[model samples]
Target: MRNRTLILGVTALAVAVTGLAAPSFAARDKMTPEQRAERMIKRLDTNSDSKVSLDELQAHMTANFKAFDTNGDGQISADEMQAKRQAFRDARKAWQEAKSKDGKERDAALAQLKDARPAMVPGMRPKAFKRVDADGNGSLSAAEVASASEKMFKRRDKNGDGVIDAADFTKKI
Candidate 1:
């Protein structure tokens, strides 16, 4: 029971520990690219320098890995990954049901689920996981997570500035 609570807390923190006041889940859908960048920066920028360094990004990604590696196994299994997915599916189901109700009830449900925030791990698809799991061992380790995060940080640092800022998130339409 305690482990579950700890996992939930860490999972929440890893996904979106927005230091600033974050937008509603509904508003998040409407957020512009620049806005999304700023929100991500607020969550990932540990030093509060308005940007995300590779170290900061890897730290957050490692935290996510820890959360996914429930049971303190130091590696993530298919079961653990599916469990996170199931939680989001359950929340999403409830949210859809609540959508048929009156405005207040729908809004209340949205608040509780926050658009099924549990599965917000970036690019959580099987292909992405395989790419990260360099050993092909069918489980993910902390080292794989570190390597993947470094790659992710470099990919997002579009301007080659060594850190990710609003510019990375923004795109010219």
Candidate 2:
């Protein structure tokens, strides 16, 4: 009875440790380029039609155009793109200021933010902004975006199968 009790306790502890080391259930998780494309195509085909109609395509495109046309001119120019980026900076500054205005010296907070820069630069644009901006909208949206996400998974898959295996995420971004 004593030996059986010790084994059960060890097993329970091991199970608990394994659970703690695993990823949480709520993670949206990163997807490969091919997965991204396949998902986009699925989303675009909302009605399950084999092909996406011009109207559906147009709706998606128009929504994307509106996002990059910051000046409401129905076109996205370089200047407008710059303005949008500046706006994001301003918003971040304002949010940080508001959160830390309790008479705290912000040097440490600012330094921490600076350390987070390298990762953020890539997020500002999806690939080369100009190349992916198929319609020259200066930004990307579902319509302007390409389906290369699934390709990312394919490159990591190694087996060429459509599905990504659990161990393939070791080198994921």
| lDDT of all predictions | 0.78, 0.52
* Candidate 2: worst-modelled 10 consecutive residues by lDDT: 115-124
Count of backbone clashes, every candidate in sequence: 0, 12
Candidate of highest TM-score: 1
Q: Candidate 2: misplaced stretches above 4 Å?
A: 1-28, 32-35, 46-55, 83-127, 130-173
> What tens digits encode model 1's per-residue C-alpha lDDT throughout 122-173?
4377788777788999888888778777877888898899999877766641
Which pairs clash (backbone N, Cα, C closer than 3 Å) in model 1?
none
lDDT of 2 by residue, 17-128 (tens): 8897665543347666656655655655546743344454445545545665666755556565566666657655755875655544466446544543221111135445
Against the correct fold, how does model 1 do in TM-score?
Answer: 0.69
Q: What is the TM-score of each predicted model, taking all chains together? A: 0.69, 0.37
Per-residue lDDT for 125 in model 1?
A: 75
Scored by lDDT, the top model is: 1
Candidate 2 at residue 56, lDDT? 49
lDDT, model 2: 0.52
Q: Supply the TM-score for candidate 2.
A: 0.37
